[model samples]
Every structure is written in C-alpha cells, then in structure tokens.
Target: MEGQVVMGLQKLRVMIGSTTAIGLRALARLPHGTRLIGLAASYPVIERWLRALLCVYQPFPDIETATKYIRRFIPAGHEHSDVVSQLKQFADVTRESDYPVLFYLSGYAPGLSRVFDLGGGIGNLFYPYDRELRLPATLRWMVHDLPDKEEIVLQFAQSRHENRIGFSRRMEDASGVDLFIVSGALHYFEDELAVILARLAELPRLVVVNRTPFSRADPIVTTQVGDGYVHACKLHSLAATIAGMEAVGYRLVARWPVHERASRVPLRPDLNDTYWGLFFVLEADRRRRDASL
Candidate 1:
C-alpha cells in the first residue's frame, strides 16, 4: 500500500536521521483504500529531539507525580530508561483504572507529537507506556487509533479495558467524567484540523494528550519530514504546532517530563539515549443536553 511504503521510507530515514512522525493527507473524495505513493524526500537533522532529550536527562522534571501515574511505564524498550519505564508503568495503570467511557475522537498529527498523539500507531510504544504507568483497573479507557491501525488496537484494547469505551450519552452532562484520555494519540495533525475536535469540543471534561510535545519556551524545534528518495522536504517546528493547539479550545492543563530508573528484563536496560518526553492535557467544555431535549 502507498501508506505502508511511505511510512517505510520515512522510517528508513529516521533510523539514520533526527526526527520522525507518521502522516499522509487524503482528500475527502478519495475512495477508500486508495493508496498514494509518497515520493521520498532528503533527510535532515533537527536537534530538537536531541536537545530535549539531553535537558530532561540532565535536569529532569519532578517525576514524583508521574509516579501517581505508575500505569504509563512498562517493558521499556532499548535502555530501560526512567522515562520509558515510567510510561510502561502508566499504561499498566490505565489498564486498571475506572476512567472508562472513551470519547473515541481522532485527527492527524502535525508530524510532531507536542500536545499529544492524535491517532494510535502500530509503532508499539504502548509496551513502554504500560511499563511506565500501568493502566488502572479502576478506570475505563478508550483507545484511539486510525482505522488502518484499529484491529491491532482493538485486540489490545479488548485484552485490557474490555467493554467500557465510548462517550457515554450524557457523560458530559454527568457533571464531568473522571478523565478523558488521548493516551497515545496526537501526532498526525495540524491546527483546526478535524470533525473530531468539534465533537470533543462539545463533550468530555478532561483530555490527556499522553504523547505529544509542548515547547512554547523555544522556537527552533523543527524537523524535516524527509522522503527516502526525494531531494528535500519541508521542515515543521514543534513550537508552532503547540501554539495552534492553544488556538483551539484545548488549554494546557499539566506538563511534565517522563522518567524511570534502570532495570532488568521486565525492563530493557540497553537504552542508548534518554528520550525527550512531554505530555499535555486539554479541556473541552461541552453542552449539557438534557434527556428531554
């Protein structure tokens, strides 16, 4: 498929370059399953990821609270870094939390996960997220991924959260749902980009973009989405993207660096470098439609 090929080419470069984010725009009129070959572009180094990683590695954000989110970290891949383990622990928590009733909304990532990951990926980072913060049995969760990535997410979603997933009718009106999560969604889109936001704008109390960036403090964190075969590609800045998110209803609620300690097999102790982790949660004020309305 064109999508697969494009992504493969992109990955090939990331294996050698600085940043990577999956994306491909499709027209509303395009027929289902139509493949669009993404001509490859030249790879470029964007040190944003590198700098962020180093900063967190040195003077890391306070991880005590992220510990409350012990459900995000898990079988942290590569070096079993604190961040990876914490994420895994976090996912494990989500698997057990009572915050169910998924407001399964979605959109494309702006090729950068600043505020959060908008759509799920087969990228399989959940393994680490689960190890960092284990999914809580006390919460009900909704997994958001693209249709192409659904079957896999569904398989995982069912194995963990089971049946409690959806924007339960009147849930927004129930004063407020415990938590509205975007978990691993929010990297494949741009500003004002969706039918999903308009809906989420009218529902859910809290939105946690578990996997995106938030760097308003700087303005140089941009990366080129290079094609494997093309000579060049456009560069996208992470700072600009977060600004767009604020423009919409989403406001920055909380942000912290994800970190974890070194470990054993349950943890991958071979981490090569510290990951530059950032997470942001957005809130939406929905209308309260009564049963009689």
Candidate 2:
C-alpha cells in the first residue's frame, strides 16, 4: 500500500505550512532504487537520535494525554472546545455499557499514519485497555483515518508480522467489526460523511470517537500562518461528526472526559501539540443479520 500523490508543494505548504512537505516531496521524487539509500545517508543522525530519544520519553498512551497535547498549543475550548463538549454530550447519552468497544481516529500525517492509534499522544486514548493489557469486549477496536493514512497503516501492519491489534488486513481478514472509532479523523471529511457511517454500520457493535471537530472544519492541527504565523487546523466538532454518523446509521453510546495533563514524547515532536478532552463512542450491532458471518 502507498499514500496518495496528492497535494503539490505550494498547496501543501499552505496546508501544513511545514518544511516537512518539501522533504516528503524530495523523498517521493527520489528514484525508488536510491530512495532508501538516500534517506539513510541523509537522515542517519535523525534516525539515531530518534531511536535514542525514544528511551527517555515515556508516558501512558491514553486519551487524556492526547487532549492535553492538543489543548497545549491549539485552542480547545472558548470557541474551540465546543467540539469536546459535543462529544461529552454524546457520551452522556450512553450511561449503560461498562466497557464498550473503543474506536480512535486522527487526521492524516506523514510518518504517523502507520499505526492503529485510538486517539492521540502515542495513542493515549486506548491506554487504559492497552496499559492494563485488557481485551475489548468482542474486540471491535478501530483505527480510522484518511485512505492514504490507512494505506500507510496497511504497510506497517504487514511488517509487524502479527499482533492482537488486528487492524492489519491480513490479520483482520475482514471488512468490519464490532466497534469503529475516529478521534482526530472525522474532521477531514466535509463531504461523503455517509461513507464513514456506512463503514460504521458494517461493524458488529460499539463505537468510540474522540478529538474530532464540528463544522467549518476547524482544521484542528496547526499550519504555518502568514509569514511565521500558525493557524490551528480545524477538526470536526464532536456534534457535527456524531450527527453525520447518525445520518448514516449508528448511535452515540458514551462520551466523557479522561482529563490528563500535557506530556511530551520528546522525540515525537508531533505529539507535543497540546490536547486534553473527552472519551466518546457510538455503537450499533451489525444490522445485516448473519451477514459477514
């Protein structure tokens, strides 16, 4: 699987407003034969430093931490925090389940797209489960993102051989599951909200959504603003994303805050952006009785 070759430098520079786009362009432009060699030669120090840096920076991969990181830099509430409130409101709707299947989504990023992260900050949202090493009921763990990011996930999952995470297609060997989650991922889709819902409907039960945006597409992440300026990228407000999910089928199960303080990966500069917010999930048992069974 490969990422899409979309977004030219000028457009991307405006989108992410980062030099990373330029480097990715260079990396992409490199002939396949020499690309690896060129990357190794160019980034030997970066690779080594990252490897060593991983040793020092350790924190629970939980949702609260993610929200903390997001809120650290990007404005969460005021007007921004409305997204979190909507998620909380939705979560309030579901006072039932003790442990529901959790789905986490995030917007697309270059290197970060390759993992099954349920919410942000080294996948902090799912930390309790993974930390406790507990398995989800019926295990409908979801890792949602853009198609390109999902493509990256496919590649990485392939290399990992096998793990219970089951996001890997070969391992999952299935189209849908019990729960579907999208943390930061929901905002990217301004159109075709129905497709995401349809995807959710195919699943068996439960859904969790966190860190998504409402309308006007907040672009939750930051982009280089005018000159040195940085504009917060909009993520879908929780209400809008939930409404869209409801439009396609599926209902909100739970939403609540996992409040956490900001922490840094140190090596993962991307995680440094502050965020702290709610835990949200939506669920519906597969409607097509005995289908995909």
Q: What is the lDDT of residue 127 in candidate 1?
A: 42
Best by lDDT: 2
Q: List model 1 lDDT by residue over 156-252, tens digit each.
A: 5456645433222222232233334443333223322222344342433344544333232322122212222111111122444445545444555
Which ranges of candidate 2 are over 4 A from the true structure?
Answer: 1-128, 136-162, 166-174, 190-194, 199-201, 215-234, 257-286, 289-293
| Candidate 2 residue-wise lDDT, 1-293, digit = tens | 12233324334433442343334334444466235533553586865643332221212233344335433333323222344334334422422221332233222111121233333222223434443334433343344432333443344435543233333333132234433344554433433333444543243333454443332322223221223222233333345555655654466544544223222222222223233233323343435433211
Q: Show model 1 residue runs off by greater than 4 Å.
A: 1-140, 157-161, 165-178, 192-196, 199-201, 214-251, 259-293
Error of 1 at 131 (Å): 11
**Candidate 1 TM-score, C-alpha based:** 0.35
Candidate 2 lDDT at 214 equals 36
What number of backbone clashes does candidate 1 have, counting pairs of residues 3 or more apart or in separate chains? 107
CA lDDT of each candidate?
Answer: 0.31, 0.35
